[model samples]
Target: MASCAQKLLEIIYNRRSIRKYHRKPIPDDVLKAILEAGRQAPSARNLQPYCFIIVRDQELKKRLIFSEWNRFIEEAPVVIVGCGDSRAKWAVVDVAIALQNMVIAAEALGLGTCWIGHFIEEEVKKLLRIPEHIKVVAMITLGYPAEKPGPRPKKSLEELIRYETYE
Candidate 1:
């Protein structure tokens, strides 16, 4: 069996922003595990001021389209809207971390996820009846992958990391 670190590396290195998906739906147990991973993410002050809206209704998914490029969202088996409290200073970061946790968990479970960053906040809120006190941080589309995407380019560690301070 692989060590935890090795397993995590495999999951991270293999993950891709999957845009196309198979028609099959995710199993309930698997979906719960993914959501649980998000629930366990660390937050500032441990406030965990994040909430996720799971969208499986086909009609609702169709109505979520705010752009032509995002039409693939409606094709996925599920779409999760990550929202955070507007009053929390770290709400956006907290929600992003939680959603990333769910992304990694979904990848580990042989599922694909795509982060949906472009959307009209007002439209989404109106469609989902989200409260005014909450902000839509992001959304993610999840499902079985229909395409095997190769790894996209990334900067080297040396290029991305800094030892101490800006020179």
Candidate 2:
């Protein structure tokens, strides 16, 4: 067994952008934990101006996936839509931080998540009846993963790092 910090590091290293998911629905408590993680995320000036929409209805999920690459969203048991207030200066940034927290929390809890950024925002807002004042910043799919993918190649630290200025 690994220590808490070790376990977290392991989870971070192993986390994947899971698209294929099992049909099992996330437990109420687990879902709450995930949401709480997002809620706890820090926002600029402590505004935290964001709303989350939980979608489990098959029809709605089916309608939300507009891209072929994101079609797997319809198969997941849960989808979390992060909406931010356009009036806020850092609305989308706040929502993005929260969404990343949620994704990490889901991974730690034995669930998988995939952050989806491409979609028809207007269509989604119209379908969900989101207020005109709110902006649909991002969407995420959550469920038990059906596939385990190997790690993809990554750039070396030396290649990406610079000392003081552009190298």
Candidate 3:
């Protein structure tokens, strides 16, 4: 069996919010595997109320480049829009968890991914023709990484972690 610690660290540290990507397309099988990982993520009451909109259309992607953070989505081979069913109380939270699962899975598969914030939710909903009943939680650009990001500075354990109680 794989060491859980090693696997977890590998998935967490290896994953980067990639901003640059190769134009080469990802295989359908790889995409399916990533999506399956998301589907398997635990959700509130198992109410996996989320929808994925996979956008590969160049024109549509270009039109989606309205946000500064999402400009790279236009060049990626695939962009996944994670939408939450508004009826579920934990819809956004659940989709966020699922999206993280998908990101880690993509890293394990040697694919690069970046989580794009839903800065223009209303515009994006209209552009994607998504129903009002769905909330656009997040978006992600997926493809082969063009560049590896340098290790970003992180808060030390002492600065971030609190022992039992918040002191």
Candidate 4:
């Protein structure tokens, strides 16, 4: 049997930015697990200054999809909008961590996830009713994948790693 670390590495390597999705609602328990993963992520000074907006309404999702680049928002069964309180100096970093946690959790559960960032901020805020103080960090689409993509190439460890300090 593979160790937990080994299993996690496999999940990390296998994770893909899935956009196409089948029309299947996530089970309540499974969804809860994914949400909990985000909530449990560590935040600076324990403020946990992040919120996940679960958009399941078809009509609203349609409105959120402002362009062809984001059409997956309309097809996904759920879209989680990760917001951060801009008052915190580390808000962006904190929210990003939590969002990644949810993505990893989804991948581990045989679900597909995609991080979407190219959208009109003002329009999104209006559709989601996000407050002025909260910045929309990123949104992720989630569902059963309709397409399976092969692994994309990545930089080797030698090229990416920096020893001790910048070379």
lDDT of each: 0.95, 0.94, 0.90, 0.92
The candidate scoring highest on lDDT is 1
Hey, what RMSD does candidate 4 come out at?
1.2
TM-score of 3: 0.93
Comparing candidate 1 with candidate 3, which one achieves the higher TM-score? 1
Best by TM-score: 1
TM-score of each: 0.96, 0.94, 0.93, 0.96
Off by over 4 Å in 3: 1-5
Model 4 TM-score relative to the real fold: 0.96
- Please give the lDDT score at residue 101 for candidate 4: 96
**Per-residue lDDT of 78 in model 3:** 93
Candidate 1 off by > 4 Å: none
**Structure candidate 2, residue pairs in collision:** none
**lDDT value, residue 72 of candidate 3:** 86
In candidate 1, which residue pairs get closer than 3 Å at backbone N, Cα or C atoms, i.e. clash? none
Model 4, span 68-132: residue lDDT tens: 88888889999999999999999999999999999999999999999988878899999889999
lDDT tens per residue, model 3, 1-167: 46988897877986778889999899999999999999999999999999999999999898778767668888799989999999999999999999999999898988899888756899889999999899999988899999899777889999999999997
Clashes of 4: 0
Deviation of model 4 at 129, angstroms: 1.2
Q: What ranking of all candidate models by TM-score puts the best one first?
A: 1, 4, 2, 3
> What pairs collide in candidate 3?
none
lDDT of 2: 0.94
Give the poorly placed runs of model 4, Cα more than 4 Å off: none
